[model samples]
Target: MPKITYITFDETQYDVEAKEGATVMETAIKNGVPGIEAECGGACSCATCHVYVDEAWAEKTGEPGAMEEDMLDFAQDADERSRLSCQIKVTDELDGLVVRIPESQA
Candidate 1:
């Protein structure tokens, strides 16, 4: 399992172990992390699970797909580092991944 760190707007951090093939949003919800909403259940149809990928882990996580890019238009305070947690698949290379939850989602 990979370890993921989720930081809320107020800087609260929740570190949890993530299954190799699970999405970041799934791991967050399962662990009771208080930032990701995942309202579309990983369908990529909503921006409720918005998060900012830490710069250090950005290349490893890769870029969001076109569909996710479309949905991100609705995310508050989105930027180059913004990503929908539901679209981020977990992998061994993602161990120690860090993501920040925007005030909008926190």
Candidate 2:
């Protein structure tokens, strides 16, 4: 299991033990973490599950694909670090992944 930390707009942190192969949005939703709406149900068609990947983990998480980047245009406060949680897969390599939920979703 990977340990994922979700930081809310107000800086509230929710650390969860995420199952391997599950998307970050799924882990957050299943663990009751606030701020990730995931309205598209991990379909990668919406920005409701937007999150900012910590700079330290950016390279490991990789860049967003064209489709995901397009969807991120709809995300509030989208930036270089912005990523849709639904598009982030969990793995042992991401053991300490940290993401921050934008205030718009808080």
Candidate 1 residue spans exceeding 4 A from truth: none
State the local distance difference test value for candidate 1. Answer: 0.94
Which 10 consecutive positions of candidate 2 have the poorest summed lDDT? 37-46
Candidate 1 local lDDT, 13-100, one digit each (tens): 9999999999999999999999788888989998999999999999998998999999999999999999999989999999999999
TM-score of each: 0.98, 0.98
TM-score of structure candidate 2: 0.98
Determine the backbone clash count of candidate 2: 0
Residue clash pairs of candidate 1: none
Best by the TM-score measure: 2
